[model samples]
Target chain A: MAALGFAALFNVPARCLPIIFLFGAVGIFVKLLLLLFGINIVFACLAGAAAIGFLSIPAAHYKHAPPLIFYIPAVIPMVPGIMAYRMMLGLIKLTESTQTLNYNTVLFETVNNGLKVLFILISLSVGVIVPMLLMRKESIKHVRVPFSKK
Target chain B: MDQAIKSVRREEMKQLGKVLLKAGTMLMSAGANTGRIRNTINRIASAFDYSVELHISQRALSLTIMDEEESSFVSKLRRTPPHVINFTILSGISKMSWNIVQDNWSSEQILADLERLEKMPHYHRWMVLSLVGLAGAGFCALANGSPMDLLFTFLASFLGLFVRQEAVKANFNPYLAIYFAALTASLIAGGAVKLGLGHADSYAFVTSVLFLIPGVPLINSFSDIIDGNIQNGITRGVNALVISFSIALGIFTSTFIYQFQ
Candidate 1:
């Protein structure tokens, strides 16, 4: 299922297949590591980002478009797809419970799922952003123009 | 290289400055790394025969030209000073320099960087989101919610940005844009559920916001703040917040309207 999603993400024209496949595999592996470590979702996401970023070194060398595509798709497995869906369902179910449907069970489930989804999204964002921030820091000093014609 | 283009008015020059500013902002936001960014700025500076001095901070990259007399021309219609336009070639060379760096760096160094990145706090967040998203789907199925809802939500969220990208040129109405998109997505999910095509209500909520997730902007803003671009970072942070609210609004509005009817 994750592979299918990753495959679908590469719907762009003229992208390098080998790079796409490499990133795709790395993306899934990152997800698997997340599952294996039982770590916070955010860490898993960061792991995925790191993987994508490292893989992008080759793409960066090739002078193709920026590494976003390579990293973005590599991180697709980490997207909050199911959590978002569950939250929507939970909200809808909560609304439905107002009409004497005896939906206490549904309400409990909804709240639990919603909270989980929220945490997941927060974690995902943090995971992806933190490393990027660090990378930015490392790269900032190196951004100097060697010969300022001034 | 020989004929100097006539100088334009100060106002015209300012306009060109604005254009260049916008371009730089766009390029930075588009995720061009600092090296590429400096090279780009230098290239632009050299094009006008203006010597470029770049000041790099966490928040922004500031460029000052030593040659003030070289009239800047960012727009195509504007008339600019004729100078030795060697900067165009320089810009291309700067890009090539990145390739050179990538080639020179050992695979071991790249791997080390990746290892270092793995230890950062933020990476955990992405993993959590992915786990929850994938796990949520299975949980939804077990809970007896509509699977079709999950499918549509996934599909819609993935494609929503592309739709918005197309609509941006014709109509920049963000509210209308997202609203319509939400409705279209809901219709797909709702229809699938009604038809018994798949589980309808299972993972729709969590999935709906996939496209609307402000991961990039949030990170950029946070980085900006950490890098000392407080104003710009705060502005971006607020924008990300607003976008999050917008996604919530779109979902709330769509669901309310659908349920009410």
Candidate 2:
């Protein structure tokens, strides 16, 4: 959850910071609750992304900034570093002939890991964007957030 | 007076269209989501009392503005190259876009605004270096690191981020920057572990280097694809994948060479 500090690190205006924090926290909380139910990881991520997206819509309305300003940073903490690492490790094993692990086993694991990472990426994007799609087209009426250049 | 008025209006449209495109180009280059890019540009044009017909592709942006006579349209196109995040400039542009929506800034005023937005000082260099490096320690903690692991993570992250910034500023390929940064971080983490630094496994190394991952592109690519911008989405997705592959390659090289367990 500390990784969600990216909104601040990315220099998001302080007025909009607290709400982005809440949206990110809610997203993570939802994902954890789903996981405790033994929900599949991809679905959990999609749900998390959805919660982030849903919450950020109101935040965006309140902050008068782009929905993405809140949603993208809110979802950053869930990008799944372990799956990416595993995928890379599996590929490494498959490429080298000297590995103690069998080549077929390595290949299978590599493919599985790659697919999982791809699905997670897909889920995160689709999850957030679905909200935008379902909502009314964004108009200029709400673009009122003041930003500091500092 | 009517003749003079027509000529002046023509001049205003020409300048407004040019600067509006300029703002859109920079925003695209900075990697704002595709949807926001279109909305912001549209708002700028509407502010100037011109409607634009825009065509956005993977590498370039093109838009057309109708001539005052309605018989022809003037078009402008620009190629956009992705750059490092400068939230100050981005946030400044956002404010400018809002101001355009709220005020009837003259064409020259809009042009000046664009220039000032472009010139806003970037965030402090050392602050970025330290905080981003601190993000490395944050990753280690997320990985359940011991205190020793946190120290090593901080050192590796800060050092690697410096090199990565240098490579990017030198206009090295994005893949090369990711690979170099990941390799540096992993080597530092692995070396510290090898020296009996009290870390038990190589997972800390992976976590330390995870900051090199391209979170923005990955998410933006998906956003593009979902927006039905197939060409832009695929290009962004490929770019993100290549960068991730480079990062993985760097980590694999470290593991292979150092034989980190």
Candidate 3:
């Protein structure tokens, strides 16, 4: 939540901060809950994304802003900075090591780290889009209808 | 009579196309994802009784707008740079797009609104810098660091941002700014590590650099690709990867120098 607040202060409107903060905290909780139930790491990320995506819809209506205005900033905290760094570090180490057999572990670790980051990203984006697609279809049905802050 | 009617329709198409083109460019400049940019233009066109054909690439946008009478069309082209994201301008444009979609205003009013928005001041620079530092500290806590580590991360990131802003103010390249900022931040944190200051974890050092990562480009890259915007997606993705590579290179250099000491 504090991470979300920090992000909101950087790129979001003051009035929309609280909702963005809430979306992130709850989204991470959803991820944790899925993990507790033995869900795969990729599935856990998907659940987290869906959680925020669902939460942001009503908030977007209230703020009269697009859901993405909040969604992207809120998700910043979860970006795998350490994993990416480790991937780079491992690759460098693999290159410097003269022993081919021992360096293979470094290569494996680098690829594994990169893959993990990729999967989490894929899950987050795909999960969020699923709800957005449904919502967009609903909006089109009411093309001539007047919009409300509600 | 038919020829006269077609010319009049063409004029309307041109007028509408100009406005729509401007909106698309603004959204792209403000870092809107590919999908949102396309949809916003579509919404605006539908509201105005035109259905538009749009083609967005890495460096340009083209739109063909057909008027309600279907008698004529106007096409527009704009060269674009994927400029840095600013939420204030983005929010203004978002509101304007909604208003346009709602059919609540005329072209004149929308352009006036856009004019004001382009001139609107964003948050104070010092405040933005502080908040960016705060974000780094928050990442420290998020990384499971101790309170001391959080404080250390805050101060390090604060100074890091100052150096970055200075580099930017001096008109250094964006990637260069990131490099200087990372080197400055991680160097300080590295000094702390050498001296074994506090109980702060080494993780806090990396948190100082997090604020400079290419979050928008990465997210937009995937979104564009998933939406089948292959060209723009690949462009954005490569752009992001380059920045990421820059950051990694910066960190590697700093750590490499530290090894010699």
Best lDDT among the predictions, by candidate number: 3
Supply candidate 3's per-residue lDDT for A25. 79
TM, every model = 0.57, 0.88, 0.90
Model 1: interface root-mean-square deviation in Å: 11.8
Give the per-residue lDDT digits (tens) of candidate 3, residues B219-240: 7787788788888889988988
Count of backbone collisions within predicted model 3: 0
lDDT of 2 by residue, B1-261 (tens): 988877776777778778877887787776686776787787777776677878886578898887546754578888876755545556667777877667767767877877887776545667656766666776677567888888888888877877787888998987898889989988898888778884675556877777777777778888877777777788878888898878888888888788763
For candidate 3, the iRMS in Å is 3.7
The better candidate by TM-score, 2 or 3, is 3
C-alpha displacement of A94 in model 3, angstroms? 0.7
Error of 2 at B245 (Å): 1.8
Clashing pairs in 3: none
Give the per-residue lDDT digits (tens) of candidate 3, residues A89-130: 788887789898878888889999989988887787777766
Off by over 4 Å in 2: A1-5, A97-101, A138-150, B1-6, B67-69
Scored against the true structure, residue A82 in model 3 reaches a CA lDDT of: 75
lDDT of 1 by residue, A9-76 (tens): 32322334356556756755786688688976556756666667666654743744444445544554
Q: What is the interface RMSD of each candidate, in Å?
A: 11.8, 5.5, 3.7
TM-score of chain B of each: 0.50, 0.92, 0.89
